[model samples]
Target chain A: MTAAATAEPTRRDFLYIATAAVGSVGAAAALSPLVSQMNPDASTIAAGAPVDVDLGSIQPGQIIQVFWRSKPIFIFNRTPKDIKLAQDADWQSLRDPQPDSARVKQGHEQWLVVIGICTHLGCIPLPHQGGFDGWFCPCHGSQYDSSGRIRQGPAPLNLQLPPYEFLSASRIRIGENSQA
Target chain B: MSGYSTYKPQSPFMQWLERRLPIASLIHSSFIAYPTPRNLNYWWTFGGILTFMLGVQIVTGVVLAMHYTPQVDFAFDSVESIMRDVNYGWLLRYIHANGASFFFLAVYIHIARGMYYGSYKEPREVLWILGVILYLLMVVTGFMGYVLPWGQMSFWAATVITNLFSALPGIGDPIVTWLWGGYAVGNPTLNRFYSLHYLLPFIIAGVVVLHIWALHVVGQNNPTGVEPKTEKDTVAFTPYATVKDAFFIGLFCILFAYFIFYIPNYLQHSDNYIPANPGQTPTHIVPEWYYLPFYAILRAIPNKLAGVIALGLAIISLAFLPWLDTSRVRSANYRPAYRVFLLVFFAAVIGLGYLGSQEPTGGYVIAARILTLYYFGFLYVILPLLGLFETTKPLPNSISESVLREGSPAGASAPASGA
Candidate 1:
């Protein structure tokens, strides 16, 4: 073979490189819609609009569930004893650590709102059950404290906190972090 | 193409077609005159039975899909309509539902037969992997199909299973959302699952073609674990193996028919009859019976991620069994120690299955953990060690010898009237 034949990149090499690069880009571009289509659509996203909940009738130590974007939101009217119990628990040694103060709205500690779904496998936790004065997930035995902190079982995290803020002393808007 | 036969088409048209497409000759060679071990037992019949079950599932599934609505609102009512309104829809629905259970039953037995005979050894590694792939596909298809009715069990099962992905540290939540096609398992999830459920069976059928092709290439492993040596050691596939396969298939059909007619809902959980309620999860959520053992395995671990990883490895490990088992002898009959361990392994599996059905608490959790240890140990430890330490019995010289030997299993051997 001639030295020039092996020394330099041939025209065919340029063609091959260009073809492969273009082919890969085309394939990825084509695949984008297939993957993108699986995401939450426009309607599902819009369905998550803020829901104003009436906490007026809710009794202390009582829990009521309401839906926002098809998810169960548990609103608890915390009694003094429940708040004390939640505050007294050691927050540092927990599986997922957060103080009772952090979980509830500041100055509105009497009202506790959390997404009722278990962090382990999305099963709804039964209210007012388990050793903790909060909720117990029956599906995999995950127990949460009155503050909805993970206390026991296989759940990796505490009950998820939804985006919400108080509208008034007895009213709250869920699915919105602040006044709209 | 084991060189078992040379096809000579009798008719001119057949000869002409054979020359062009050669499908006629291929079928003749692969099925009609293919060589199979003469000493194959009743356990060997499950492969044919599984194939028939696959056909039954696809045909019934296709027909059922015609009337079944995929929307969340209509899905549950549509199924009810099928049961109450559509002509013979009840029969079709019952058969399709029960068919999945029966299909798993046959595949499990077929897999057990393979494991016992060391069919995954050496030349058949690819075949075994294909079988494992087929099994995985079947599992996904079955899980998706179960969700189609939009029952309470279906909804919760979908939720719990999809939540398994969230065990991943970083990208897990996103993947789970992508899988759901929304924030939760809703109409989009159901629609996609329906589409995939319809798409997967055809893919399984394609892989099955590869599986059988691989099987024909390397040939079958027999109960004796000895490769057939000559014409005396084997018989033609047609008439001999075909007849036996048909007989067992008929027996399997009888059991299937009984389920369809008498106790149709016996295999199905009653909770599924109730329409899906996302807000309220059932007190105790259990998966389908076929998945019980793995469910038990998953719950056996205390950590969420570990449990998910363990559940995944439990299935993926089956694909690597050919290498994991270091034994040269294929048949468990010769490996006495291996045989005992194998039976114990089966017991553990059955134990796990039972525990999977029960709540994962107290003694059941402890028992499931112990059995889970045995399940992994049998594959990773016992199988490798037994192959090295155990003194296996002397093997039969050939398939013919094993069958013809004195005190051999009666009726297992082909009749003296012979092929």
Candidate 2:
């Protein structure tokens, strides 16, 4: 219904425009603090710095949890059969298709390194539980296979892999890697 | 607003102020002398009530903030101190907390009034969209405010809601991380939220200025949904509209004070009194009552990303309402089919809200799903089809005619206090 068809520009229209322009300029001037507040504060950025883990003590078939970037990182020392199961699984049918070799470094197949939080809703998944048993998130019943792919669950992707690399035979640094 | 301004300032100070700023004249023209439809109802009073509530929230919030600490460790104790140690702090805290709920209650009624009258129809589309933007801003502000207590419910609500962003495709986790300023809802997140929560209300105020400016620009939509055709159909805003608004606001304060004094914690979760422990999640997690209908819509869908999108759309869909309902007729008063559907739609929303509060299971999930479907269907299906097929009743010739026909309380009788 062209109900209030006052589209024709008038002196009041110009007044509104001029005032709004001034207001917008003032808003832009005030926006720096609004934006800068969201940036990682010094303490938070410091907390996010690279964390080093000594995997020497992490025996095969053992899973150790380490904190890096304020997230739990799981360093799993997979057994030979676990690695085989992870690798030999049909990667083609994965909800989030990433092969087992891709999740770990070239010679680090037995050392499965991934973030401990579930891909579904960030609840920490229980290690070696649920069907196909890599990690099971009890929050919403999301299942992750040994390779960490979302095999048969509501999690859209596999558990996230932090930027990490093998610094030595039994050591790794998270939050910084050559590729990333 | 009364076809021409005869506003000539006789007072020396007003003349001096008018020449320098002209804001005095603008206010007078927009508020006092503005011609409101003679038949405007108590529903119209909500705009003034909302403005008053915003002022209440800001005043109480600023005072509360003087004592409140943003640190997660101190946040809970700081709120307790506000309740226990600070003088008049308990009253201030209670009023501010319940003020938010009352604000929502007012805004929801205001929106319902607009919908029933089709205030969003042509010429007011921009105004309606601005209102939606204001609603979005309020939702964000409310959510951030909810997290400031750092209580169990507050902390977990922050966790669940911020993680809702992570359902986005590739940038989801990154956005969530950025939002949190870390991997989880922590001190950094709390700090940012506190800052933004304080900031958004001012922005809402700014939008409210524009909302009123647009209302004054286009003029008010009355119950008859008919535009003012002549000077006889409208009256100056000063005595009639202002008094009615004041009367309603006074009545509303009784209810507001009731909640503030008698049952401040009724709207709050018992779980929120307990401090937040990331390790221990409460058995049943739900947002505040105002957010439940939306929370229900989100959970009704099984897929994570889709659920998030559905929830997003539940709010965003409102912006499209002006265009979606293609009826030339402006009000449901004349449209019989629309009137029934609107009733059902409101009930479904209430049902969805109730279902959202319960544990999502065999019965609740089924109910939520059905209600969620109806919620979407009301806007997406019912409104559009009703526009095409509904047989509308004949409109009264003008607003004055409708008011005269009914012997309305707000009628042609001259206001006692004239402008």
Candidate 3:
């Protein structure tokens, strides 16, 4: 047994290792399809295609919810006061700190587009409800500011921004973003 | 480990089969002729009760699944149709649903019995750990099973639970999306959860087999925490243990039947009857009552990532208990201080569970925090420290001594059943 332990690697050992390695690779390759099949399928991906929201009908201080990829998207047409209140609040002192300008398009600051799901848990927040005048999650007491930044609650981050770019001044396409 | 098996086949065919397979003799040695400590009380019956509950859940779940639809659009209506249309469907659905609660109830009692008797100590650690694995599987299986109806509580519970993965730093969001199988909890999510719900119970059954195997290897821990030193200390597992188990199982089944026949939906949340709507959440979203203690632990912490970790640790901590508890004494009956602490620990867990159902508000949050502290402190701090300092009461030299001290003839009658 000692001699066997001290001896150089034999052809049988190499064969065993080679067979085991190849078998593992084969097993992994077989499992890949089974595992990846659970991911977003072609139709689900197609269903999540960029939705075009026509912002022409929106009035100031109005927040209209639209479904994009089965998630509620809150399109808040921020009034001048709403935008000012969002900007004037000390961004650094907030729970999830981000400047209002960073959240919305610099020129399109009046139009705040955010995925309306609560950051703490994925419940759709009630718009214009909470002390922050943005959203309040009823499931847990997570609150968001008018700029969609988390103000005061258990939520750890700002309300997420969907990928969107301005098609024209009054039109935007969600799920597609372009450089400023 | 107990006594030598004297299994002799009675007939030619059985003898031949036994020579070839020996499965009958194996069962004879393990179950029929196995030497069980005569001192095992009603608490020991939970193992058999749990096995029965598992079978009950599986048979009922499989029948319910035959009629249940796993689509987002049809899942809720499918359950409704099962209640109204399918023959004996409501019975199967109620049995399967309530079976989950009673199953957890039995497991909790079983665990408490183990802790009280220090059954998780050295020789039985593997058995305890396997039980923990079964418990974790049961939790996941139960969660997914609740998601099958696609009700308000089910959908939101899935969303929030799957989002727990998002508490991880960099890969969190991707993992959450992977779990959902799409952008959000919808058709794909429901389908995968249904598939897994069906698959997990069988895995639990497998683990339970190992749990029993481990139990048989170590043998049952008795109230005295004393190992059987002589044949008189033990009784054959057949008529004695089986009869006791059957009696308790009958009583347990009566309770289970009462829940199913009379107040079937009493344990269930009324909000679950409402169809799952992604746009609106229930006024207060809570998980099944079995999960309340851990849920309370999760919400006790204010931070998201930390809370998720705390929740995971709450379950995982039980696996480490065999080592955390450094007491040489096996049973709480011998450990005076440990017994008091054990009862307090039970109360804290019950308190936290109550807090979990209430709204997470000012007074409730504070209460939950206090209980959560005691919950962890009892396991991590008190258990380890008490073992080293506290003096234990005098223990019986052997299992038979304890039984004799009680003036019970059960142990003496063991040898009367001569093979």
Best-performing candidate as measured by lDDT: 1
Best by DockQ: 1
A8-118: candidate 2 lDDT, tens digit per residue: 777777888899999999999899787676666788778788988999898878878888876778889999888999989889778788889889899778888898877
Q: How many residue pairs clash in each candidate?
A: 0, 0, 0
What are the per-residue Cα lDDT tens digits for candidate 2 across B125-210? Answer: 98899889988998999999999999988887888888889898899877887798776788889998999899999999999988
User: Arrange candidates by lDDT, highest first: which order?
Assistant: 1, 3, 2
Write the number of the candidate with greater lDDT, choosing between 1 and 2: 1
What TM-score, to 2 decimal places, does chain A of model 2 have?
0.86
Q: Which residue runs does candidate 1 get wrong by more than 4 Å?
A: A1-7, B407-419
Candidate 3: residue B88 lDDT (0-100): 92
User: Which digits, one per residue and each the tens of the lDDT, describe model 1 over residues B233-310?
Assistant: 888899889999999999999999999999999999999999999889888889999999999999999999999999
Weakest 10 consecutive residues of candidate 3 chain B by summed lDDT: B410-419
**Interface RMSD, Å, model 1:** 1.0
Candidate 2: regions farther than 4 A off: A1-37, A41-46, A49-66, A73-116, A124-154, A158-180, B1-4, B408-419
lDDT per residue for candidate 3 within B232-261, as digits (tens), equals: 888889988888889999999999999999
Model 3, position B41: C-alpha lDDT score: 80
Collision pairs in model 2 = none
